[model samples]
Target: MKLFNFHTHNKSENYGIINIYPEENILFGKKYSCGLHPWHYSENYETALSQIELLAKEEKIIAVGETGFDPKSPVNIDMQSKIFVKHIEISEKYNLPLIIHCVKHYNELVKIKSQLKPENIWILHGFNGKIDIAKKLVEQGLYFSLSENILKDIKKADSLLEIIPTDTIFFETDDKDYNIETIYKFVAEKYSMTLSDLVKYIEINLKIMGI
Candidate 1:
């Protein structure tokens, strides 16, 4: 059975979804998601919007983002919010799920979500925060995408795995040079589940989300 990587910057040999660069138009015949990240914000919003609008409709493009607020970024938050709103509109229009990239601006992100009231399923990629914050976000109907960073400390990862809902859990390597199998093994052990079972769970989850 193959692993289902919810968000990866580079294409994987295993069965998983990867992210397509916004500057590129081709889909490359693989499962992927496309969106303009907040850190890459440019003055030319119209150009970015056009590119996203055109590429997001592809059958292979399963989700609508890696876009969201980034408090540490030098780019203006207002600018990031504007682009993020555009992504939400496109995602909702296409009926695709959203893969978010949030930093220290969780509150602002939630505020935008409440205001927009979008229907697309939203998953925050690379989550490595406190369980309290995770609980708050999960309560708000947000999904969590665990990354290799979480594996840096097995005890902490086990603790988080015990708390985060299995149904809401997903995993990814993002841009890291790490093995998804390693992630699966660790998580499966924590949950006392077989690796294949964990892979199947993610597959079912993605299918349910219409990815």
Candidate 2:
């Protein structure tokens, strides 16, 4: 079976979707997730955001983000929150699941999520936070997307996998050079499931999220 890499900037060697920033070079006929990242905040943000609103309607776009909080970034937190909310609005308008990029601001993000109570699914990509935080986020109906960074600490990865419900979790290559198959192999070993079972589990998530 082909591996499902729910998020990544690079093209999939196996069957999976790629994330394309609106400003990046575009190609035809490939699956893509489109949004304005918080890291891209600038004076001309309104202009960029207007463009995203248009791109969100494009047929090739499957999801609506990599956009969310990043408190440690040089970008103003308030601006990030504003733009992130706009992305959420766009996601809702288009009925696309959101792929988030949070960093050291889970609480703030959770607060906004609580206030918005959005119907569309929200996915926190590259999650490596404390288990308690993960539990809280999961409680709020947010799904977690794991990337190759988890492999840097096998024990932690095992523990996180233990806590995270298999059904709400997803694996990705993100922007890393690692292949999605490697992530699948490691996760299957951690869960003591066959590679095919892991694939089936993620496929179920994709279906649930309407990806």
TM-score for every candidate vs. truth? 0.92, 0.93
TM-score, model 2 to reference? 0.93
Model 1 / residue 21 / CA error / Å:
2.3
- Top TM-score prediction, candidate number: 2
Q: What lDDT tens digits, residue by residue, belong to model 1 across residues 56-98?
A: 6656577887888786655787888888888999999989898
For the record, the alpha-carbon RMSD of candidate 1 to the native fold, in angstroms, is 1.7
Q: What is the C-alpha local distance difference test score of each model?
A: 0.81, 0.83
Pairs of colliding residues, candidate 1: none
lDDT of 2 at 98: 91
lDDT of 2 by residue, 61-125 (tens): 77888888876655788878888998999889888889999989888899999999999999999
Model 2: how far residue 42 lies from native, Å: 2.0
Error of 2 at 81 (Å): 0.7
